[model samples]
Target chain A: MNVVIGIDIGGTKTKIGLVDEKGKCHIKTFFRTREFPDLDDYLDKIKSVSDELVENLDKKVTILGCGIGAPNASSKKGTIENASNLVWKGSVPILEKLKERMNIPMRIMNDASAAALGEMLFGGGKKMTDFIVITLGTGFGAGIVANGQLIDGYDGFAGELGHVDMTIGDGRLTGLGVRGGLEAYVSATGLKRTIMYMLSKYLVVSKFRGISYNDLHGEDITKAAEEGDIIAQRAFDYTAKMMAQALANFTAFTQPEAFILMGGLTNSGKWIMEPLESYFNEYLLEVYKGKVKLLESSMDGKTAAICGAAALIWENEKS
Target chain B: MNVVIGIDIGGTKTKIGLVDEKGKCHIKTFFRTREFPDLDDYLDKIKSVSDELVENLDKKVTILGCGIGAPNASSKKGTIENASNLVWKGSVPILEKLKERMNIPMRIMNDASAAALGEMLFGGGKKMTDFIVITLGTGFGAGIVANGQLIDGYDGFAGELGHVDMTIGDGRLTGLGVRGGLEAYVSATGLKRTIMYMLSKYLVVSKFRGISYNDLHGEDITKAAEEGDIIAQRAFDYTAKMMAQALANFTAFTQPEAFILMGGLTNSGKWIMEPLESYFNEYLLEVYKGKVKLLESSMDGKTAAICGAAALIWENEKS
Candidate 1:
């Protein structure tokens, strides 16, 4: 009857779940993060939701610990620091404040890394010792696992693959101001940008021509590409090429057995995955050729966030 | 007394040292490697040198085990696989054959990774849990240490930073056939190549115009730059720029406390170091700007190889 609270905090919404050791969420609750911009109000809401979830349970159960996954979070500091996407601007000591409200032991980490640990414990990476989990959403994030353990070096800031200084790009800047960075070419935002750029460069007709920059999505591109749109096909090709280069370089760093990818960008399906595999092999060093594999995520986005959060507690507790 | 045999194999010569647990080389000997094209003869010479080091000892000593560091070596397979620099053509099972010849326990690893373990045990990285060691002699190599352990992923080929795909350069290719690789612009041979390329592209007059490509060395460039030669200074500046870009990318991957550099390129002094520091800081992500330091290798090249090899066995034995 033991359970842990897993919280996945987004910029707009926060999802909370009561999870068991096998990564199943028995019950779920949520609150709007933007609605409670005040720190006290936000903390109060989080406390109320957590308390209500435990209180409403019909059967007796033991609450073990709490795990939180959020943007710009540091496991060492137990806080989220300068998370641009979050309503809370500066460092928020979520772990300390949450522990004060609930007596359970709590741990916090960057969402990407939490997902990686989840993959390690329950996903396709269960049997692998060294691998990287890439999240290609509004931005690109990576969770690096080496020597069979999750690595969060120097205050949980390692494996920021999105911000890696890059050369293959259309001179667009990353959210961090790195020109031609990997994220500038591979993220969901990057896909929209690519389609826009390709439309301007090519003389061919396409469905994406009139759409504004932010209005375009990966799903639209996928549908158009399936219907035989050359511009859409070209965008996926270009994005895959840059991602392949980044993955190829990552191979030299960790020499991972495989690269497991997640996020909205994966929805592009065969358009990106096929080229990613081919280009990845082409760019790999001779020693690593025909060895490293590009894999799809076994968990969906929402399930990954919640399950990964829960796994963080179980992963540490078991070890 | 108790000791271990540390063998550091090179393309031209091989060094054999009888090292104690404290990392002191009690007795050292050597034999020509390129001189013995036959694998059997090379193995015999290595056996004789190791035997001589033990027999010639003035005091009674217990030989515990053996550790070897060599090019293209795989610790898992215990073989030197297709090393272009060595006379042996295919996979030479040095570990198996050496075990048959001597009957003592032995371990083998790549020289660069061995130097990293050497640093973790006896040099600047001793107190650090995460760091990278960069060897920039005739070519570039890297030893990555994370979670206070040396990492050699899947067949001992993980830390090949020299072969990381690069974006900056004057169209130079690495020995591994990688174009614009990090090694193409950061080693002794890199310096030579840079000077030649600059002389061809620029109209600047300098002291290096007449020298043949094979005759050039890092020392000559260091001397010329010290004497205020413009092209020499430019070569160092360009090399430092590319190297800094690489180190910045490495920081994002490992988030190491520092980068410890060894080999001939460090001798370039302020010419490279000053620019390297500035460029690295400028290129780093905002969170990691001031956190990573560039440190000189505390152990010399020869000491690093032997001591690191000895430390390999001692490290495993202690743990």
Candidate 2:
């Protein structure tokens, strides 16, 4: 079995794992990503940890490939372009740096794209040829799979569905200067704003009071929703409607077999999924109605991204 | 060189032509399409005309391929499924029927998709691997190309850019029950409605003073705009802005190489093109600004659809 090492870099934490050809993951570990001031120091820690894992292995397994999943990691450019959340302000040659440390072939792709690869190889989309993987976390991200292949456009920058204009007319303003996008209404950060706006419009009581915007998480809102908080429920409802519209627009672009939901907010389960399903059907073109299916991601948290990166390496080996 | 016959079936007119591997077209002819009630009669005429063209060939053109472009044509199912404009009330086996008359293989696709393939292989997209073909006729239709291949989703029903929602809030009812779609505002029929809405809102005079809704065409308005009519200019400006927003959303999904404009309304040239270019740039993402080029279709009139159909056959042969 050809074993590949997978790494997932995130703003909060970084995860490393060793995966074999059968899609089994082992030797998983996590560390704080904010500790390092520069890329070299971060990579040194990665190499040291990987060295510790392989030192005592029986028969000394050879690493066939390495794949890293990070924000703005581009497959065509072979670099991680300036990520918004990351402290770095310029493109990072991660794949090139990793190549010198390990003599194996290495690849890099955006986290959402990697997640799509993971889903296609071993998760929910294993049996499907066309589908979309939507990550509704701090920000919304999408990966499009059509004709049994990940749609990496001319510059390997396809599947940017968060920016798809979901609202018409004087739409909600996007941070990118465009108005009314899926990200502005459906993302974790967007949901909090929705809740705040609803609070101002109507009187509401909460378990906690006087908190910073950065302190608000999707879990806190969902918890309040579970406790029969009307404001929280309304926030989720609006998000579901907005997300469904965006998905409907996506369906118009590519009639996917299903839409697989991932990331932190998907944990809300029925609160989001039920209404999304209803609104999706309501907004879908007649021919597409009752045809496309919806499902939640099988992989959870950082594991999905790590698994996806390993899958990319496995795919490269086979190809 | 393998020569193929292409047929473009429209509500009012049908075009037929012989096309070689090099995109050279000959034996072109056109006739009224609605004269026959049954498709079999139409096929009979096509057979006679095609037979006459191939009669005196030195070598038997036994390997002649055929490709048909029709409204609502499904590339995957090989049928024209209930086009309202056409008299046919059900799915028409366009490819199968054509194959029965010829010894060689044949295929069929929606006219817009055929146009996209034609543009990719023979027109503005000849040097492009990723581009979108937007057909500006009775209704706005788009065909998407990604990763150097046409994107036909699970049901072969992708690239429905026209139906993408551009309107937000109330007072908008879509054919799909969704509010504010690009087709709702930018189609040729939609343009006429826009003109009528402007007339009700502002004072205007026109040669089309007595023209009925059904009688109003994109050409009449194009001529009026050329003659320095304010109402006509306003209608084009409004439609162009709506189209630009749609294109911006398209770019978000797939950063295409270029957008190739085709069909009847694009014949208006600068009146439509100038406003469209400015609006597209206005709405484009900062990263993608000035990256996507817009070009007019190299194919003209009936030949555009014929060439598109032939291009499909040629592509299938090479594959």
Can you write out model 1's per-residue Cα lDDT over B1-90, one digit (the tens) per residue?
Answer: 989888888887788888887778888877778889988888888888888888999978898899998887887789998886898878
Pairs clashing in candidate 2? A168-B166, B166-B180
Position B150, candidate 2: lDDT: 82
- Candidate 2: tens digits of C-alpha lDDT, residues B1-319: 4678888888888888888776777667877888877888888888877777666444455446888888778888988877768987787886778667776778888788888888887777878888999987777788888878888888777877677766645534444454676776777777888888777777777655567778888888999998988888988998888888888888877788788888777887888899999999987776677788888887766587888888888997777
DockQ of 2: 0.70
In candidate 1, what are the lDDT values of residues A193-233, reduced to their tens digit? 88888988998989887777778877989999999999999
For every candidate, the chain B TM-score is 0.96, 0.91
Return the lDDT, model 2, position A295: 89
Q: Which regions of candidate 2 deviate over 4 angstroms?
A: A56-59, A175-177, A204-212, B55-63, B169-178, B204-212
Computed on alpha carbons, the lDDT of every model, listed in order, comes to 0.85, 0.80
- Badly placed stretches (over 4 Å) of model 1 are A56-59, A168-170, B168-170
- Every model's TM-score: 0.97, 0.93
| Residue B308 error, candidate 1, Å | 1.3
